[model samples]
Target chain A: MTMQNKLAWPKKITVCEVGPRDGLQNEKVLLTVEQKIELIERSVQAGAKIIEIGSFVHPKAVPQMADTDEVVKKMKRVDGVEYRALVMNLRGLERAEAVGIKKAKLTVSASPTHSLKNLNKTPEEAVRGFAECAKYAAAHGIELSGAISTAFGCCFEGRVPLEQVISVVKCFKEIGVSELSLSDTTGMANPQQVYEYSVKVREQFTDIDWVLHFHNTRGMGLSNVMAGMLAGIERYDSCFAGLGGCPFAPGASGNIATEDLVHMLSEMGIDTGYDLAEGIAIGRRVREFIGHDTDSSVLRAGRCSDIVIEQ
Target chain B: MTMQNKLAWPKKITVCEVGPRDGLQNEKVLLTVEQKIELIERSVQAGAKIIEIGSFVHPKAVPQMADTDEVVKKMKRVDGVEYRALVMNLRGLERAEAVGIKKAKLTVSASPTHSLKNLNKTPEEAVRGFAECAKYAAAHGIELSGAISTAFGCCFEGRVPLEQVISVVKCFKEIGVSELSLSDTTGMANPQQVYEYSVKVREQFTDIDWVLHFHNTRGMGLSNVMAGMLAGIERYDSCFAGLGGCPFAPGASGNIATEDLVHMLSEMGIDTGYDLAEGIAIGRRVREFIGHDTDSSVLRAGRCSDIVIEQ
Candidate 1:
């Protein structure tokens, strides 16, 4: 596609598949560390460059992801692919750092209530926790990516003021954090909110790369993604088949489905170096593995061109 | 809520729920007429004014919607609700008319191969058939709404020429179609195509209402809906729980899920006069009634705010 073609439309955007970590954590079936590694390998083969391998949360709290270290250790490190792991606190950061994990994400809830319930800390404490985690990552030569959960809105608190998100971003940036992700932890984000929030973040911090983490809990995941894309933010986190929801976060759903996101981007003629059908197929396999139907519509319904006209 | 709030954004964006018609027809387990009627009643209650309740297709061909007459007969007629039935030809139109359907939608495929396989007629023959259906509807004091399926692009034919869609729109207008719906029958539409196509149709038929029928096959359904909405086309079709697809249309899924569409519109503070939570609940009820899950993500995961956070 030429520049005019690119400008005449939204480019086919690259997708970051977060299914292995974000998707599996919410499942009732606890896949073995081998299964998690296999899932990551399949996702990479399916053309996922950035994959969330696992979270370094307490095994006691999230038994499903108990083998995060083993899974990450055994992961086949592709030449160009980036491996990501989620860390919630200083201890999790230490666990990731100990595993030689080079890149990890730190999440803090914007809503004080969610922070308390989910992390056993307040928003301020969570920010402090990130500050600590970022410091630890820096000392250990790991890249720290901070995500403000409930940046768009919160389930417990209802509406999280944009000021709170800005403050969180400001605090994170003050500690030399250059990569940030805005999360709709409860999926309360509308397109306008996404646009306004994204624009606000971009205006405040021009140097940082901001990724959007949206949930389809209320069915606005793709719309929010579009709004974020239109607002000039590119990186987004999606799960295959729109699966995975936090068992702790009430009403939280799987992130936007990777296949659905890729489908949209591919249709826009943006090159993601990914296969749409393969993405859907992998999503279905994951769905079968989990033994539950996923929320992704595209996985079951193939692309428009897949229509078979019977005579 | 208020006129100021409603007009604060775009006003009167038409959302036609095609769940009863488009959504149910694609399911393996066919719903009874009573269940279909109940779904339609809830749809109208949820502020769907234009409901595509059923189609007049052959029973053997689409056994899922075999009881179109019974469904149409039992549907509660609201004062402003414009109920529509899909008609593929003169025979379908006669059946729709016999059932007292005041508004009948006639479809002609833009892709020749699809038209031949789907309707066993050439494009010219399908157009002529719609023209005759229009005349018949007019004589019977019913309105004819003409739709061109695969207008954006076809699965078999690949890229559908822009002129082909425009020509069909012109023919429908010339035949005095008060309304026209351009369908991405196989989900071959992207935001750019949606934008370009709607602009083209608007320029050609300034007097006719252009309704868009999109499938979320590639996950661009809502984006295309927004693009069309921005292009000044208000009326569009959706399915409850995003249910519906042409069994013959191969990879096509249901139209935009009604709850998700309404959720997007309502959250923008646009007045859809619909309750998002209620729509999802209705979708759930229908899922149980049909004994299968619908493709709507919102139904499985309620709104983020709807989550009950136990203290």
Candidate 2:
């Protein structure tokens, strides 16, 4: 009948914020190194314990993330917080290790066509490269998470078979990689496909932790995230204001908007340990800073209960 | 795999455009009679077989839809096309019948608080009113469908209990209402709740033709629709450019965008016989006519495959 009389809210869920790295890299405006650090700090103050600080790509390739090392070094390290960086190759991993990035992510595309086109490597070559990165992460005590992009449907090669995605996961599994993050690179995942793919991956390695990475290109990003949550995935990667999109995936917008995701989770009584209003406010500020409208809807409209529209 | 090599696409998904009544009523813009008819005509050309043409309510209450009669009279009645309107009371029904409307929808909020606040009628009173209208439709050979709003969760009263929703559905069943359209008036439904409610409702009444009407207020509208689809609901209510929201429900947004829904269904190889590019172009044109931005994401960003991003 009333809020108090209804179901109690859910306990906090772990929210991995990837805006600084994943979000900024896709933007046209190349934020300076100081601005990136400031953004990361703001997200941390807004209660993001896991902040993806930056990436180790060459400045010529991705100028937005050129100062990954500086951004990672300058971020105010809170006690028990995890600072991560995107590392594509062994060289990138070495750079991340040098910069004290304790958690690093290595990505490989499951579709060989995409893998070759995106990374200039065959699937096997990409897997071996990530495997080398995984070994480097292991020796350096850095938490390594292998991410398989284009696991669902690929833009170049539509409807990537389940077997291809599984093989990539198996490759990561064989490489002694402890963590896996499956990405719907093109936002081609529906609930049914997400459920089926997640189940198949879970069946292979029951003990490993798998996180879901989704882009809302088809508007199913959050739906796929909920599907992943339903499939028992507790950890997810989201960008503030939904800031992440691959430059390679055209018409692909940001990842699931962090504020909307948190709002939905909090409303469902899932404890995300994040302040929703603060997140929304930060999301808005980032939009202003970026000088363009972000993909997040809740940020513009506020929560369902906040605005009172009269007929 | 190219589109040619991929699975056969689904064509011919029936879209029931509800923008004229359900959409404009929630918006601040109060279009005149001519504008409403213009929108309906454009929607009809876009291949919407079932159009919720208008609502017969007090003009002072819903100024946006004040010209219900003028719009319905101007409609070009095509064979196999159904133009419908919302009827709140016997007077509203009479008004629709006077306008030669052959199909009508009677809505009752499932939550008592919402029902009282929205319609100023108790659940029982609303049921009695709808029952009379159902009989009138039967006698006149006009079609009648019962729409239960807030069937999932209510913004005014937090989470709607499952029992209350079931009770309302049972009441609709007792009234011999064979066409039921369940609405998430406030977009408070999750996949689990939708799955449970749709299954329960379908299992209870094996013979009723059910459709899902959802608001994207909480970003779960499309996800909830997918849940309903999985539960075997084929017909759905949508608006071009996602242009519908309830003024009563705060942050209540446009219906699930028609073009976006069609895009997903077509990509999934489900037959929703609709042209996506044409639908998107129409959505953009309508948005321009409305002199405002729409909530539909696909319109702003072209189809995912259309983008040529270097990987």
lDDT of each prediction vs. the true structure? Answer: 0.77, 0.76
Q: Is the docking of candidate 1 incorrect, acceptable, medium or high quality?
A: acceptable
Question: Per-residue lDDT tens digits of candidate 2, residues B1-311?
Answer: 11112211123357788888887787776777776777788777767888898899999988877888988887677777889899887789889998898888888888887788766877656787678777777787778888988787666676777788777777777777778888887776766677677777777777888888987776777777666665667788988888876554444466898887877666555676666777887788677667887777677556656653444
Residue ranges of candidate 1 with Cα displaced over 4 Å: A1-12, A246-253, A275-293, A303-311, B1-9, B24-42, B53-76, B88-101, B246-253, B275-285, B308-311
Worst 10 residues of 1 chain B by lDDT: B1-10
User: Who wins the TM-score comparison?
Assistant: 1
Interface RMSD of 2: 9.0
State the DockQ, from 0 to 1, for candidate 2.
0.22
TM-score of 2: 0.85
Q: Where does candidate 2 stray beyond 4 Å?
A: A1-14, A28-49, A78-80, A205-208, A245-252, A305-311, B1-14, B26-49, B58-74, B78-80, B117-119, B130-132, B170-175, B203-208, B246-252, B308-311
DockQ per candidate, 2 decimals: 0.36, 0.22
For every candidate, C-alpha RMSD to the true structure in Å: 4.5, 5.4
